[model samples]
Target chain A: MTIVITAFERSPDGGKGLARDTRVRWALEEVGQPYEVRLVSFGAMKEPAHLALHPFGQIPTYEERDLGLFETGAIVFHIAERHTGLLPDDANARACAITWMFAALNTVEPPILELVTARIFESDKSWSAQRMPLVEDRVRNRLGQLSRRLGDAEWLDGAFSAGDLMMVSVLLRLRASGLLDEYPNLSAYVARGEARPAYKRAYDAQLAVNKPTAG
Target chain B: MTIVITAFERSPDGGKGLARDTRVRWALEEVGQPYEVRLVSFGAMKEPAHLALHPFGQIPTYEERDLGLFETGAIVFHIAERHTGLLPDDANARACAITWMFAALNTVEPPILELVTARIFESDKSWSAQRMPLVEDRVRNRLGQLSRRLGDAEWLDGAFSAGDLMMVSVLLRLRASGLLDEYPNLSAYVARGEARPAYKRAYDAQLAVNKPTAG
Candidate 1:
């Protein structure tokens, strides 16, 4: 059976591939898997059908044959688990890589998301300006520690496994904010992940969906 | 080799067991594993030694023999992987359960953390009140959908597993916020998780650490 994933019909990012689906796409591309995209409008996402697949009414749900999955971390993990290149053969290394994956989502992404909430959703609020700095500081704190640990290392761990993939994706949210530039190594690390051919393929695919249609 | 984990020397929660270390302690109890706790002061968390164990300078890092791990998600996941009770034996169920784990941390926890940041760190900011509603809405949106899916169901997937453990942990952040009561099912669900023997043991252990003179 063909693998199918849901994406935003019109992404809030205007097709920058920042939508969670992009992560799934990148993973599939990395594993050389062919898949189909099912575009979902914001309204459709909130409806019962989509809610059945994803309780949170979010984009980027994965369905293949009898298996249906939600949560990008889980989807990416599933892809990495079934495929060889995304995870190491060694048990310890694989465990470490999985650790990074969780770290990226659980530790790194929370602050970055806060930055988003402060900047976009709460931008109109009276305290937006003052609150942003605190949010940014929290992001920086996480990044600083992450950068220190990553000091001069190529990837977060032994090799570029799903961990790096997820970490880079989480860090990418900070790119537009310019806060990522503060940590030179972290910035370069994200660039490295983006420079991958698989990432480019995924980026282009989402970008295409984001493009405004010509009259 | 005996497994060792870290906890706050003096928890700010004052024995309420809201500290991150409590989660790790709970996971160990769930797996029926006896582990040692090495309490660290907030000052020590940033030192080189603790930093080596936890890049983010946070609590509840795990170490056994040569393996060292950080991030509560990673540590709990490690325990779940090593122990049988935390994860299901079926492959698909296991994968779905793992998906819930990510959903808890990645999707659900972000907004809850925002509420924390707004109240604790940014409470004095001009936009705090205005920004809070948005964060609360985001959380409610997640919880609403989750409640609908969990409607009349005992657990997220089949039987309770690591996924519920994580989801419960994520939801617990909302306890003080008073938002959890908005959805009766989710409230009851959290209560159910708390009622677990493992969760009680974990909660009591952290509470013990916070007892006066324990340090």
Candidate 2:
């Protein structure tokens, strides 16, 4: 069955992998799965048609035959569950890998997102300057803990699995804020994730969509 | 094998079920699976012992024999995957249910959490008053879209699966804010979730741990 996923017609990030479909695309690439992308303009995303697939009216809804999945975490998880390259075979490692996936989405991503909302959506507000540091502190607090856990390690837990994939993706959001630079090991870790051939393919694919429109 | 999950020695909410363990307890109860709770004080949660299981040093963490899981979403997802009642057998429905779980955590819960941080953590900061409306508006925007999708529906999708369990859990955080009541359907939807016997069982279980001490 052909896998179809949605993406922003013009990603707000100008084709940066922050658009999340990039993660799914990367996952599919890792597993050597050929998939299709359906770009939805911002307006169409709010309409009933797209909203049915994603109640939250967000980008990156994955559809495979009758199976339609939303939430990049869940979609990536689905891909990991079905495909061979993304998850480990050992039961304990698999469970740990899944746990890391959750950590990436639920724990690590929340604070990063807070920083984003404060900087972008709330920048015009009177409180932006005052609140930015607090949000940054929270992000650093999370990164500090994560860095200690990952001390001198190659990946989060074991070998590269979907957990590392997701965690690296979550940590990448911090690049723009220059926060990841504070943790040398974490910055290097993200560099390693980006160096993966699959990640390169995914980045190039998303970048293609964002290429400057020919005049 | 017996499952051991962590919870606050005394929940900050004093048994309001805001603690992440409540979600795990609810899942176990729904599956009719007996489990044990390991209580960690606020101080203990930050210590290395707890940090080993959860890098962020928060509860609840799940341990069963050799398997240890952190993050409420991952733990709940593990339970749902292992049990039959919490998920659907149909491949598509199951995928949809998983999508709702992600939607609840990633899309819906983040804004609600921001509101909590603004009111509680940042309240003492000079920016609290000015920053609050921005946080509230972001939450309201997400809720508005969610309410539209949930119109006249009992659950997020077809039936009361883990998806509803998580969505309701996320929305419960907003109840005290009085913002949830603004949307009748969403308000009633939460009420419907609360009325479930499983929810009551879970609520009471967490409340037991949070019983106030007599002076």
Candidate 3:
């Protein structure tokens, strides 16, 4: 059965690979799965059809035969469970890997998202400058904890499971902010993730869509 | 092997069931698993010993046999996978339910978390009053989409799976903010979750810890 997933017709990031479809694409690439992408314009994403698949009207819904699913974490985890490369065979190790996935999305990403909202949406606010540090500090706090835990480690746990895939993807958004550079080990950690053959393939795939001459 | 989880020595919410341990406890209750709770103070949570178990220094870390795990989503998911109940038998339905769990933590909870930070930490800021509407509107946007999807449904999906367990937990935090009340259906949905026997047991357990006479 062919797997079909949605992507932004044009990502708000302009194909910097920060858009969530890149995460799913990277997971599929990691697992050596060939999947089809159904591009959805921003307007189409909010339409009834897309909303039916993703109630939040988000891009990157997954469909395979009779099954439909959304949420990038779920999509990546589903792909991991179906394939061999992304999860460990050991049950305890696999559960630990899944913990990192949740930590990335829930604990780590929320502060980074608050930073995004501050920079993108609330930049014009009267108190933006003063409040920026508060937002950034919260992000740094999480990164500090994460960096400490990740000391001298290659991946989050043992190998580069979906946990690392997600943690790296979440951290990539921090590059432009320069906060990620504060933690040398985390910067290297994200770089290690980017250096993966699968990550390169996924990055190039999304970049191709945003290239100058691309459709 | 005995299953042990961590909770706050004194929850900030005063045992309103907003602490993340409540979610883990509720999942255990739903699956009829008896577990022990170890309470950690705020300072102790950041200490090396506790941090070894939970990198983020937050409550609700799970330990069983040789495995130690943190992150409420991961813990709840671990319990759901190990035990009966809390998940559907159907593959597609199971995937969809997992999608809702991610949706609650990643999508629905982020804005609500922003609201929490705004109300609690940022309440004293100069821009707090003026900037609240912006933070609030983002939350309302997500809730509106969720409410539309829920419509008259008893749960986000069928049969009250872990997805509803998680989403209801996420939404429960918003009750004090009055934002949840705007969407009657969502409020009712959360109420329905609270009305569950498992949820009540979970809530009462947490409340017992915070009561004046309790140690």
Candidate 4:
């Protein structure tokens, strides 16, 4: 069965690789999986057909044979569970690796997303200016704790498992905000992730989709 | 090995079963596993000892033998994977179940949490009144889609899997917001979850911990 994932027809990020599909694509590349992408327009995403696959009407919905899944965390985990290279063989290590994945999505990403909402959605609001610092501080607090835990380690845990993949992907969103620079180790960790051949491939692939066509 | 998890010494919700440890305890109950709880103060949660177990410095953290885990999503998932009853046996169904778990935490919960921050953390801010409708509407958008998918169904997918366990838990947070009542099916879905014997036991247990002592 061919694995098919949905991506934005035109990413809001405009090829920055911040779209969730890039993370899913990167996971496929890491696992040596060849997949197909179906681009969905922002309007069509909310249609009943797309909503059937993803109730939230979000991009990066995964379909292969009879199975369909959504949510970047789930897609990435589904890929990692089937791919040997993405998870450790040791039971404890594997469990711990899975822990980091949740930590990235649940604990760390929320504040970062709040910052995004503050900047983009509420930028025109009267209170956006006063609220920016509070939102940024929340991200910094999480980054500080994450940096301390990382503590010069190459990854969040042992080797570069799905945990690191997810943590790096989530941290990448912070680069533009410059909050990540406040923690040098996290900056280096994300840079290391970007340097991976798989990440490079995924980044290029998504960028091509979002890039403007030359005249 | 004994399974030990941490909890808030005094939950801000005052034993409303929203402190996250209740969800982990609920999963354990579904699996018929007895566990011990370690209550930690807010100050201790930020200290080195707790931070080592949970980088984000929040409860509850899971410790069994040498392996320790954190993040309510990860902790609940760890328990669900190691035991039966919480996850389905079918491969595709299992994958879909996990997808809903991610949906609950990543897609749906974020907006609700923002509403939480808006109400509790920033209640005194000048923008709180003006900004609440926006935050609440974001949560409603997700809920509308969720209600559509659920229709008359009892669970997010098939059976009472971890997906429902998580979705129900996540939606429970919205009860205080009253956003859930807008969708009758979602309200009923959460009710079904809370009506479960396992949930009852978990709820009562956490309430015991948070219940104030008589003078």
Candidate 5:
């Protein structure tokens, strides 16, 4: 079956590949799967049609044959489960890898997201300056732990898996803030993820849509 | 094999059942699995021993046989996958159910968590009152979409799977804030979850530890 996924018609990040579709695309590329993208404008995303697929009205939603799914964690996990490239053959290893995926999304990403909301949406708020440190510190605390766990390791667990894919994606959001630079190992880990051939392909694919066109 | 999990020595919520461990406990109950709980103090959770089991230094962590897993989502998922009651047999339905789990943690819970930080951690900040509306609105926005999606449905998907288990747990956080009451359907949905036999057992178990005793 041909897989069809959604992406932003024009990403808010303007081709930085922070938009979530890039993550799904990266997963597909890593697994050597060919999929089609259906772009949705911001207005259309909130429409009933998109809402039917994703209750949160976000991209990207996965559609294959009769099946439809959302949530990058779920989408990526589904892809990883069906494909050989992203998960370990050992059951315990696979479970551990999945744990990292959850940690990346629920634990690591939430604080980073708070930081993003502060920097972007709440920048004009009176508390932005004073509250910024608190938000940043929360992120640092998680990163400090993650950095220690990931010390001298090529990936989160053993070889690169969906766990690394997600950890790297979540960490990517921290790159612009320079928080990622504070931990050399994490910075190197992100660099290693970026260096992957599959990640490069996924990044270029989303960049194509997001990049500005010359008149 | 004996199944062992960890919980807070004394939950910060004082038996309100807001801790993540409650979610895992709920999952185990739903699946009819018997488990043991080891309580960890706040200081102990940050120590290297606890950090070894859970890199983020939070609980509860699951250990059974040779497998040790942290992150409530992953632990709950592991339980659901092994048991019949928490997931559907259909592959597509199962995948969709898992999607809701991620949606609850990643999308819905993040904004709620931000609301929590604002209310609890930053309550004394000068801008707390002014900035709260923005944080609350972000949660309200997600809740509005969720309320609409959940309209007239007993669960997010079908048949009270882990999706409902997780979605209900995430929504429960908003009850004290009175935000949940704004959406009658959501409030009822959470009540429905609480009414389940498994959920009741889970609630009572956590309450036993958290409820204060008179001298």
Candidate 6:
């Protein structure tokens, strides 16, 4: 069965590869899986059809045969569980790798997303400037802990499993904010992830979709 | 190997069962597994010892033999995978179950956490009052979609899988906000989760740890 995933018709990031689909596409690339992408407009995303696949009406819903799944973390894990490259063979190492996946999405990403909401949604509000520091500090606190745990390690756990893939992807969101630069190891980690041939392919593919078309 | 997990020494919710450990505890109960709990103070959570187990320095962290794991979702998932009660046997159904878990943490809970931040952390800020409605609306948007998907169904998918456990746990946080009352079906769904024997045992166990000692 062909794996079909949904992506934005035109990503809000404008080809920056920050969209969740990039993460899924990257996972597929790492696992040597060829998948098809269906672009959905923001308006259509909230339609009943899309909502049936994703309760939250979000992009990057995965469909294969009779199975449908959403949530980037879950989709990535689904792909990783079936494919060998994204998970370790050792039981303990695999559990640790899975731990990092949750840590990236649950513990680390929330504060970064709060910063995004503060910047984009609340920028016009009276207290946006004052509140920005508090939000950024929250992100910094998590990053400090993450950097400390990462220490000088090349990847989060052992080799570059899905954990590193997710951690790198989550950290990439901080680059534009300059917070990632404050943590040199994390900066290098993201660079390593970007340098991967598979990551490069996924990045270019998503870019092609979001790029402006000539008249 | 003994399964040990961590919880707040004194939960901010004061035995309200909102702590992540309760979710793990409930899963264990459902699986008919007994476990030990280690209570950690807020200060200790930031220390290197706890940070080594959980980079984010939060509860509950899972330790069994040499393999230690953190992130409530990951820990709960670890337990669910080893045990039978929390997940379906069907491959597609299990994948959907995991998707709902991610949806609970990533999609639904972020806005709710923001609301918590707005109310607890940012309450004194000048923009709290003005910004709250927007935050609440974000939550309502997600809830509306969830309720639509749930319709008259007892759970997100079939049976009370980990997905329902997580979704119910996530939605439980909204009760204090009163946002849950807007959707009657969602309110009933949470009631069903709380009514489960395993959930009651889990809730009571955490309450015992958190309840103040008598003079």
Candidate 4 CAPRI level? high
Per-residue CA lDDT of model 6 for A72-165, tens digit only, reads 9999999999998999999999999998998899889999999988888889988888889999999999999898888899999879999999
Docking class of 5: high
Task: Flag regions of model 4 displaced more than 4 Å.
Answer: none
For this target, which candidate reaches the highest DockQ against the unseen true structure?
3
TM-score of each: 0.97, 0.97, 0.99, 0.98, 0.98, 0.98
**After aligning candidate 2 to the native by TM-score, how far in Å is the CA of B203 from where it should be?**
1.1
* Candidate 5 stretches greater than 4 Å from native: none
For all the predictions, what are the DockQ values? 0.83, 0.79, 0.97, 0.89, 0.94, 0.87
lDDT of 1 by residue, A1-215 (tens): 79999999999998777899999999999999999999999999989899889988888999998889999999999999998789999877888888899999989999998888678877887777766777788899899999999998889997799999999999998889999999999999999999999999999999888889711
Candidate 1 CAPRI level: high
Candidate with top lDDT is 3
- Among residues 3 or more apart in sequence or in different chains, the pairs in candidate 3 whose N, CA or C atoms overlap within 3 Å are none
lDDT of 4 at B176: 85
| Model 6 spans with C-alpha error above 4 angstroms | none
RMSD of 3: 0.7
lDDT of 6 by residue, B1-215 (tens): 89999999999999999999999999999999999999999999999899888878889999999999999999889999999989999999999999999999888889888888889998898878888899999999989989999999999998999989999999999999999999999999999999999999999999999888811
True contacts kept of each: 0.89, 0.84, 1.00, 0.85, 1.00, 0.87
* Number of clashes found in candidate 1: 1
Error at B59, model 3, angstroms: 0.4
Number of the top TM-score candidate: 3
lDDT score at residue B28, model 1, on the 0-100 scale: 91
Worst ten in a row by lDDT for model 6 chain B: B206-215
lDDT of 5 by residue, A1-215 (tens): 99999999999999999999989999999999999999999999999899999988999999999999999999999999999899999999999999999999999999999999889998987777888888999999999999999989999999999999999999999999999999999999999999999999999999999878811
Give residue A193's error in model 2 in angstroms. 0.7
Interface RMSD of 3: 0.4
Worst 10 residues of 2 chain A by lDDT: A206-215
